[model samples]
Target: MTAEKTDTLIVGGGQAGIAMSEHLTDMGIPHLVLERNRIAERWRSERWDSLVANGPAWHDRFPGLEFDDVAPETFPPKERMAQYFEDYAKMIKAPVRTNVEVKSVQRCAGRPGFIAKTSQGEIEAQRVVAATGPFQVPAFPNIVPEESSITQIHSSNYKNPDQLAEGAVLVVGGGASGSQIAEELMRAGRKVYLSIGEHYRPPRSYRDRDYVWWLGVLGKWDEIKTQAKKKHVAFAVSGYDGGKTIDFRNMGHQGVTVLGITQSYKDGVLSFANDLAENIKEGDIAYLDVLREADAYVERNGIDLPPEPEAWDIQPDPSCVTDPILELDLKEAQVGTIIWATGFKFDFSWLDVDAFDDKGMPFHKRGISAETGVYFLGLPELTNRASSFIYGSWYDAKYIATHIGVQRNYVAYQKEK
Candidate 1:
């Protein structure tokens, strides 16, 4: 195998990887991006045909180009987004080595650089960026019984509603993916069951105002202020929010049954929490109560309100109850399809880096990791709203590129002792 060398090497050619490539090109940094498949292949292959970005087009766009200037407010379809990424690569003339799967990435041990072993060959680089992001591995619940005759499939494998088995379909997650899948299946005339977890659910719009617009007002657009409030905001905004939420009011109209947590699936009998919505609704009510208290406190303390409404409150329907997960004996219900929308997991076994946290996430301060010459991008809360989103990835990429440039400059100054 021939050994190649570059100043910077990027793993994965997805949104994050492509953004980094663009940044490197702009900075005149000699780099190569290694992708196991064609650019944006993951999105192209994994996403369903009707899949649309939860975020608006403007927010979903990358750094250099805007997606559809006229309809920037609308969410772009998956295929269009894929095309946009492909066009981004061509526009920047990014140096990419497609079909090169990186088997392992390790420090040079005694050397100043790192070695990347790939299917094609070996490459050495002074700097490496693991832009693989999350969702590399699909997370499934172990509570699912092995003896069941039902066909189980992760959301990654699900394409269309027709692919699901006939009978009541139980979707195992309540997040964006699960909600959308459940809606789709229900629209296709299937009895859909949605298991509601403690997921984020934001209003689709606030008094005719888009949530993205409010996000800007809430300091989600201001990087410094947002980062400063991360500790306080982390817990509140950790789960899925913003556009990921489904229109629950319409979900009932569409004939989708929302249930609580799945306790167990044994003997073809699926049991769930009886009072799933009670806790969830109570939490929502408590949150609203807190908001009301905070508003009163602000008024008492003579705190000036921001431009938006200061005391806005939402009254959830007290009568609404999420249906309990019926104990369906596999033999009786004969349910065929079990879609686990349980969420995603990260796999980092290949990249032997010491910067990972206990959850296997790379420990980085605004995309710059502890290990010098290494960075992470396209992760939730990495910096701010842009951290996990495509638009956010560009911000992370720019910061990382600047850091790399600074490191390269310092390397130039350092001399062998």
Candidate 2:
């Protein structure tokens, strides 16, 4: 097979990969983006029809472009966002090799580069950026049974409410995805039961002011530094009110019962943890009270801070009822569909580097991995508020590109012999 060469190779041409490509182009770096499908294919294929971004329009832009003029200050629909990414790739002229599936990535033996084996051919690059985001793999809870008569599907596979069975639908997980799906199912006249878990919920509008307004005030958009501070901030602000949070409450208003955590599904019967929602909501509120106190302290101290704000103070309604675990005989209850909206996990089996920890994510400091030329973007708390989000990857990309440039210059001079 023919072997191509470049200064850098970026895997996964989604939001993070696109951002890295833009930064590399701006720096005049010769890099190649290898994607298994067309750009932003995940967003195009996975998200639902009524889906819109959780963040405001102003916060949705990538490196050079802004989403301000296209949609109003509100959240843009998923289709519009996908189109925006396509436009971004066109505007930057990002050299992306579509339909090239990367099979494996290994360090080039005794060379200052990496060798990527793909379905098409081999590529040699001095550096590789794993821009694949967290949603690479769907995370299903162990509580789900192996043998159940009811059909089970993850949120990724779920397209619309029509796909679910006619009887009662149990949405396992109270996160944004689970809650939104439950809402849609309830709206479609299905008897929906939502299995609530540890989740953060906030008002759609607080005191007639947009939630984004508070985000700006709290500096949720700022960059982060230091591991201790990063941990504190990540744990505190991990779940900002994505549009799904508010939709969950609306579903309750529409007569959807929020149940406890799902325990197991066996012999056609679904069991759940008793009083799970009460425990989870209590825990969530107690945690938020602490964060609120901390925020008050920060304001009282008059500290000038960065743009990213803490995520802890968002609260859920305390009056919501928690359904007891269903001990119903499978034949009697007639539950038909089970939608797992648990969450996502990272898969890095293709990366043949020692930089990854036991969790499969590369051990990195500000996007620079332990491996010499390998880097990462879109990791949680990488630079700040933007690290995990599509809008934040650009900042990380700019920094990583600058570092790569310096390293390339040093290597060129060393090879002058």
Best by TM-score: 1
Expressed as tens digits, the lDDT of each residue in 1-417 for candidate 1 is 567999999998889999999989989999999989988886788866677776677666875788754276677777787888888998999998789999998888888888999998899999899888766888888876665677898898899987776787888876667777787788788887777656444444443445565455544455464225323111112112224334443465556766667778776687877755664554455344434444454567676754235224433433235335446565575567889987677777888878788886678899888887778877777887557778778888999999999989988895769
lDDT of 2 by residue, 203-300 (tens): 34333334455555656556232433213211212112344224343455567776677777676666766775554565456345434644574578
Runs of candidate 2 exceeding 4 Å displacement: 207-209, 221-250, 275-280, 283-323, 326-330, 414-417
What are the TM-scores, per candidate, against the unseen true structure?
A: 0.84, 0.84
Show where candidate 1 strays beyond 4 Å: 221-245, 279-323, 414-417
| Cα-based lDDT for every prediction | 0.72, 0.72
Worst 10 residues of 2 by lDDT: 230-239
